[model samples]
Target: MRKLILFDLDGTLVDIFDEHINSFIRMEKEVFGVDIAPEDMIKNIGHPARVVIAGPLLERGIDPKVIEKRMETAYQSYKKQLGKALKRIGEDVVLPGVFRLLEVLSQRGEILGLITGNISTVGMLILERTGLVKYFKVHSFGDVAAKRSQMIERAVELAEEKYGFTIKKEDVFIVGDSIPDIRGGKEFGCKTIAVATGLTKGSDLEKEKPDFLFSSLENTEEVLKAFGDQI
Candidate 1:
């Protein structure tokens, strides 16, 4: 049986948390004529863009109903302008060992998918820019869900449909760099692999007790080993 390997975007595959935040800032200012302070959404990097942006809006006493409607507009605006913003300011988003690991996995014929907090448009832009989009056959984005577990569920369904195969939850590995990713994988009964290459500390990730944990994906060989006999 082929394992369905799902990856998270942003800090997991690409180190673009700063760029991501900047894009959000640019979107708010350019589209809505609103300026958000950097600190408002900086620390909440790994969360869904909707949730991340909502925090400061809510803190400012924006009505929940108004924010929801505005968020939808922001989502669309963000998608449209993201490409330009990224091209203008985005740096090398790919992280260490990312290419090697993806290459090895593809060569070995593992089914690859993406489950990211970014909406599909932003996620695809980032992936395409990095030349990483070709590797994935399935995708689940944050626009479909407010939580990571729901995104994982959506990815599982898409993978089954796209690849024409059923997958055991245990054979599905959710690899990411955040507490939400780890917890979501656990909640959905899939194997979790935590990499501490993002905002979360190693100790914090350790406490989540993922099936596998790595300080960074830079060690490609060891990470593959952690995938067990399936690799």
Candidate 2:
């Protein structure tokens, strides 16, 4: 049996909450001429960015093609701005205990993978900048499709194909910071571990019925104690 752990990047691994919110606001205003409220935008934080943009465009009767073009332009602007912002903020720091936990897991021969809503480019940039890129052996990006479940499904498939091992639904864990992460993981019958490091609070995540919940990556010891033996 192979034990695989899939992590969500933005909130679970790196703290980019405010940077993302502001970046989206800037892009939305530049391309759509509409200022999105942070609260409203926060609601869609953990899903694919393209799907998030397209949903509202459809509601407003905009053609998907046009919306896609505008989104590309907006994303370009966001990339430039985000690059500058990252320099000022320095490389993102890992949440407490993350390094230690990942080190232990890697040494134990557990498969570590990434399934994030961020596009491949942006996700890679963040991981490279944070020096955490080495931890992930497989990744599924949001740019592949807007649906979260679809992204995870692809990641799982890639894992199976690349590693030459079968992964049971229960043997896979999706660790992330929002309800969508929990929902998507469950949709595929994988275990869900919710963390309260992003927009959603622990209490709110609890109501969503994830298999597990934690305040932050600092709970690494607890996580290992809970799941390490299974691996």
On TM-score, the leading prediction is 1
Q: List model 1 lDDT by residue over 106-182, tens digit each.
A: 99988999988888888888888888988999999888888889899999998888878888997899999999999
Clashing pairs in 2: none
Off-target runs (Cα >4 Å) in candidate 1 are: 30-34, 88-91, 229-231
Model 2 misses residue 53 by how many Å?
A: 3.0
Whole-model Cα lDDT per candidate?
Answer: 0.84, 0.80
lDDT of 2 at 43: 65
For model 2, residues 1-231, the per-residue Cα lDDT tens digits are 668899998888888778777877777777877767777677678889786555555665777788877877866776766676666553436676677778888888888999888778778888888878889999999888677788888988999999988888878888988888999988888888888987788999999899888888775568875564622
What's the CA RMSD for each of the models? 2.0, 2.2
Q: Give TM per candidate.
A: 0.92, 0.90
